[model samples]
Target: MTASTLSAHHVGITVNDLEELLAFYRDVLGLTVVDRFAVGGDAFADAVGVEEGRAEFAHLEAGGIRIELVEYDPEARGSPAAGLNQPGATHVGLAVDDLEAFYADLPESVSTISEPRTTESGTSILFLRDPESNLIEVLES
Candidate 1:
């Protein structure tokens, strides 16, 4: 039997601070906010493997891709290793038209691993951390 696999639904990032993450993704990164909702009660707790769980979710869209940012009341926090070589390390990749311009305008609150580096293939890549310290890989080709 053929394996059933559909296209990705969305990329979900668990965050401790919802407001700050929203501002970074929406205002700084220029993603559009599509929806916002709050979930809790029995079903939520069961699905999350927690005795009690409540969360606020914000959905943002960029380049036709959806990014779901969620904040839990109990505050689930984890940082994938500082380097990308670690197992289970994950990051969201984004593309920009002008990486230099974007970097120049970045606020001090934003943390960048380094300035954009252009590979021999003429593709520029940058690594940045969100307010929650989640990694985001940005490229311009």
Candidate 2:
């Protein structure tokens, strides 16, 4: 028997600084800003399961997926690393057409934990830490 697999729609991440995030994801990494909305209005709050208030968010499209960058009023802090040995919280993997050029374009904002290298699978990949300390995988497939 065959069953359908779940498809990921979008991933929402809370950010304290929208400007920094936008610069990293949009300017540095080159994700397209598809849309944006200010969090307010009871309808919008209810829909997203949050209390009504003046929050702000940006919808970014990267590699055919949606990334919601939210700045909630009374902003929330990002999670601490799960553990040094374990993979840090959630990571978003991005496919780069040109790994070298991409690495060259990265701003000082994102720290390169490891430089670009080839995996056993012959995949060229690298790890980066975002401003919020979230791990990001840049791979060439």
Candidate 3:
């Protein structure tokens, strides 16, 4: 596509556990796995900004949102996930008809920042971290 024809693409998240994260998205979140592939070598490393990086990647999509999961070389894993307030960090937001019910149904392993609360705008919202500490926002639809 030309520069003037640019459009939105997928959001990429580097993960420590590809399989687990893949399962979380595909099973728990109900996203469909669209593609899976592996890449490595100098070109791959240069393109991904990881030195000597080889990675397995999966693309998942549903409800018009697409996500790309990348697992870097096993021996050279990255650091802990960044907090939401940290620069350059991004979080995913989702809507549910019943925020309280959704929060209650979440697996015990999922850690939330706090109980669901009503914001100034009157939207019931909650924040939870995924297995890998990636922040997610859940709001009442």
Candidate 4:
């Protein structure tokens, strides 16, 4: 239960298009592609808690963290935008060695949301929203 004992494994987000999302994470953010998989038949069906009998997913690694991007078929189920940024919504905050360099390299759309400020706890950070409006925090180390 201590800080040293608590570890973050990965954060998963459902996206509408796998290729587009992969481009953003891979090219724009400079994350490395770690793994990818397409699942179908009974194994996928049971593992994902889905009745579609298939699944598609990719994994990206950046800043020592893993991001899992999932793309399910349109008719498979609900909407991806349904719970984004709601009151109880959760997003990942990543720490960077060079905050200024990271900010400078971001695209216009992503840069626009980089409102740099200091937290009450005295941590320097910049906040931005992804294409999906998921709040992302880049903290200065």
Order of the predicted models by TM-score, top scorer first: 1, 3, 2, 4
* Candidate 4 lDDT for residue 77: 50
Deviation (Å) of 103 in candidate 1: 1.1
State TM-scores per candidate: 0.89, 0.78, 0.84, 0.77
lDDT at position 72, candidate 4: 78
**Winner of 2 and 3 under lDDT:** 3
Q: Which one wins on lDDT?
A: 1
lDDT string for model 2 (1-141, tens) is: 559888888888778898888778887778999988885788877776666545788989987899888888755555767433576457778898888888887776678877899989899998897787767789986
Model 2 ranges with Cα > 4 A deviation: 1-6, 41-54, 82-88
Candidate ordering by lDDT (highest first):
1, 3, 2, 4
lDDT tens digits by residue: candidate 3, 100-121: 8888888888789999999999
* Tens-digit lDDT track of model 4 for 71-117: 87533554444243665666667788888788877888673454567
Any idea what lDDT model 3 has? 0.85
lDDT of candidate 2 at residue 79, scale 0 to 100 = 71
Error at 13, model 1, angstroms: 0.5
Candidate 3, clashing residue pairs?
none
Clash pairs (backbone) in predicted model 1 = none
User: Model 3 clash tally?
Assistant: 0
Per-residue error (Å), model 3, residue 91 = 1.0
